[model samples]
Target: MTNRSEAGWNFDNSYAWLPKTFYSSLNPTPVSKPKLIIFNEKLAESLGLNGRNLQSEEGTEIFAGNRLPDGAVPLAQAYAGHQFGHFAMLGDGRAILLGEQITPDGKRVDIQLKGSGRTPYSRGGDGRAALGPMLREYIISESMQALGIPTTRSLAVVTTGEDIIRETLLPGAVLTRTASSHLRVATFQYAANWGTDEDVRTLADYTINRHYPDIEENENRYLSLLEEVIKRQASLIAKWQLVGFIHGVMNTDNMAISGETIDYGPCAFMDTYDPATVFSSIDRQGRYAYGNQPYIGGWNLARFAETLLPLLHEDEKKAIGIAEDALAGYNEQFQSYWLAGMRAKLGLLNEEKEDETLIADLFKMMHAYQADYTNTFRALTFEDYEDTALFGSKEFTQWHEQWQARRGKQEKSNELSHQVMQSSNPAVIPRNHRVEEALKAAVEEGDFSVMEKLLQVLAKPFAHTPDQEEYCELPEPSKTPYRTFCGT
Candidate 1:
């Protein structure tokens, strides 16, 4: 066994200092015969971890839950969340946040284990995750980071060498996840619902100091903190929309307080232009559908705002007023972000007042024509087509005329603008149909070729590769509908 000081985890954990109700002190459930499938060396390097050490026999055992790492403090956090618009008490049911690791760069990242085993928050279900979901998270989380989004990165994946029965028998796996912190919007709600007003205030102060330090000295510190988070969420979700990413599950618990995307369950990038697109089997009501994401995000943030009211002002009525004001900024911030993203997608610069109309016109045309979302943007990179020929339809051609007139004002060359737009618009995303195909082959046929190929293509999503043109194709019309599963 390694000594506590040997693993480089020497400091005290602040989250553990909270009330007993805030978390459960538990260690990870040890697995039988653990074997690592993959470890993210790139991410480990970014965290200043010794990559070779992580790949060593002793480190693999620690990450796979077979043994605790030196200086590790494993605990399951407690939180209450509004699941599908209804309040429910929840927490790290299948996860154990190992502890904070301070990188040499001075960044603090939480080391957590998913599919580690049952905890107090397990709630009568198996705490193990299947191999497919584990790998899916590893792929998507790393891709999101490459795209410059704030997200929880996957560090390692290990097979338990055991089976977990979900629908049919499936291979169980564990994921070592890294995040700025495991705090969610639900964290604050849990404290408030438990009648811990002082704790709620303390949490808000902690969060502000950690993430939004500049706002801490403000007169309306809590309210300012709420506004800042709303702005961050607004910008983050807007980026997701611009890239055709569908989170599928946007429950309050899955929404990170630090504005990073977390919990990639049944998530898929859209292949077609449908605002009502939803892939998660559990999302039957379309509550968290593609177009509804921004609205749902605002609703989730409002819940977080309500939890901070007690800390916003001493008077209840005044507090409520302040919270409402902060809530009101969400929509405006979201629209500003959405419009800016749309402009980039259209290769528009120096937004004129009428730029919003031009962007809206493009989406209306796309939705009406049912264009393939990824292909539409990607096709613009085809050098064979003249810039004007990009607008094949008369309706689209009219909008192109207006766009070019606006483009003429830019000092940069048109070639430079086109290059920038190409990078922003991805040539490939983890298409739902293809992801399912890969999952089926891996599970039913024990083939990982499809999975490996898609991962390689997605790693350089914007590059044009003639040899990999098959990756850009949409699903066949005959095999039109593809339903996704939550795999719970």
Candidate 2:
């Protein structure tokens, strides 16, 4: 064996540099009889790792939390947040950061093992993840990455060979997650809540340097960073809507400071159109529903703005003024991004002021008729004046007429625009009912074929596959499942 100091990590290290009170310096609780269940070969290679090695004993040992690798600085991160509108301090309760890995492409990504075990922040609860949730996260997160959404990717998943008791007994598991960094808005709030202004400023500056470097040259660097984050959040949500994704939980702490989507808890994709759609059972109030995502995002950002008040300006009045101005940009940014996404969904090219009216009218009709969001868009892929059977309603025809009327003014052809819309609108999504069906089969029986099939279909969401038209159809009225749950 190589000397500890001389041995290469196959990964690098970068601490959060947080104050002692911000986090508990705890290493992962080693697991017994750890066995690798899944490893993301493509993601491993993207990070300049050996895919073969990842499938080997050494990789399995490290990934399963059975052995801490060289250069590993395992520590649980800390942060505070508003959970379901109530303030609560939370941290990496069941997760420990292994360190950072600089890819061959020169991108720095965090290597974290989640559900490894309890830490100081466990807060009187067991810090273990069930096998079903671990598998669901792996399937859904990788699907999100394949869909081109900015998200945290799953690197590996391992079965802990130990049982955990929940409502009933269940198998235990751990997930290795990768991202730019795990810092969240809640991270800064933790410092502001318990620590001094100095810690807030340090975090704000470090975040700006790491994620929003271009803002550093600006005069109001902190304000600039806030504005940039607002824009990113807006665009991110817009993209989610475009692809029929629902985050399910949009709590302040879950909002990543890196502006990447995190925490796949109870998350799902829309199968039918409904603005008030909510799948997460914990979200009984429907706060983080499909249409309410943008609003919830704004609320989360407001919390972040509150934490940065001390750094906004010297005078209390001036600080509020600065923050108000920055926060106000969220609505405009969200509108612009949302409109662009809607336009792409409908296959509109020219920027006519009337485009908004046409899109709004379609949504009104959709809401009125209880239409299927994914199917409506997928129907547009086969746009033929002769083939009216593909469209479900006269309302779609009316909307199409309005869209064509506007398109008549553009320099593009109907065929060209249709092709563009087809590409923008996906043919398949991880349907809520289907995902549930898959999970049920996996949990009740040891069958994962259904889940594997769904994964394969979603891996190329834009493509039309033969003998898979069943996957594209909407869920039956009676079969419509609602109220998903946070596995924890």
> Each model's C-alpha lDDT?
0.81, 0.81
lDDT of 1 by residue, 338-374 (tens): 8887777667666688888877786787788777787
* Alpha-carbon deviation at 195 in model 1, angstroms: 3.8
Q: Which 10 successive residues of model 2 have the least lDDT summed?
A: 1-10
TM-scores for all candidates: the values are 0.94, 0.94
Question: Which window of ten consecutive residues has the lowest lDDT sum in model 1?
Answer: 381-390
**Model 2 residue 362 lDDT?**
75
The per-residue C-alpha lDDT of model 1 at residue 34 equals 82
Candidate 2: count of backbone clashes, pairs at least 3 residues apart or interchain: 1
| Candidate 2 Cα misplacement greater than 4 A, ranges | 1-9, 384-392, 479-481
In model 1, the runs with Cα more than 4 Å from the true position are: 3-12, 381-392, 445-449, 478-480
Cα lDDT tens digits, model 2, 365-440, are 7677666787776666666333223255787777788877787887888888877887787777778778878877
